[model samples]
Target: MINGSTNEFIDRISTCQDTVFIYKGKKYWFQGYMPNENTVHMEIFQIDPAKEGYVWEYNGSSITEGQEEFQIAPIFDGKTFWEVEQEMEWVDC
Candidate 1:
């Protein structure tokens, strides 16, 4: 788990250009935070056979060079960063 306050996690995510995390065996790319709603917007990733790498899709639009369909898991669990930190593992990609 992250050993700091939620602010720390917010700071980390805010500064990092590309933040990817693994939660419950799935890869999630951190999009941004919704402070007022207390939710995090994350894009779900899947392996793209054509690109030979991972890719994320938004609203049926591909962000990478692949045609795979993926979903955006906007974390609406109403959990704080500190609570979420316990379940997420940061990926160094």
Candidate 2:
């Protein structure tokens, strides 16, 4: 889990800027994160504007329903999406 607030997570990942990652020939992009209640809202683009994967509001404990849908989101382990992005090569958008 992230060791700090959601904003902190966002700041930490900002160094990556906007980026895309290819996993198993699949493309994923980083959108943004928002902190709500005791959870963090994470959003990522799966297929441009129509498709978004794994858009969720997650607290340190669990994931609850998000405001958006079409979450084909990758498996999130409580870390920021950028943390996951660091593990993959960048793909040009």
Candidate 3:
């Protein structure tokens, strides 16, 4: 919790994965962490728009990597997806 508001790290959903967004044809993997004070349950994978691998995590757990659907929301970051999905009916990316 950066500011206790949770919104502090909200928009980082897209860049929060081991993905390859090309420009000079070089891919970079950014790291994101969502600590729940104790344990961390997350899965990093790729969905769409990004042929590379993206990560989606939460304070809990998911069924599998291939089961994470719903893009406009999940943000595919990890903790943010978990937090937003259950609260706002957002989709998992």
lDDT agreement with native, every candidate: 0.42, 0.42, 0.35
Worst 10 residues of 3 by lDDT: 19-28
The digit string of per-residue lDDT tens for model 3 on 28-78 reads: 233344454444334444433355554443443332222233233345344
What lDDT does candidate 3 reach at residue 15? 30
Model 1: how far is 2 from its true place, Å? 6.6
For candidate 3, the TM-score is 0.21
Cα deviation of 24, candidate 1, in Å: 0.8
Q: Choose 2 or 3, whichever is better by TM-score.
A: 2
Model 3 scores what on Cα lDDT?
Answer: 0.35
Best by TM-score: 1
Candidate 2, 1-81: lDDT as tens digits: 222343433443343244455543455565444455555444455543445445332223223333222133345445434
RMSD of each: 10.8, 9.4, 13.5
Per-model TM-score versus the true fold: 0.39, 0.36, 0.21
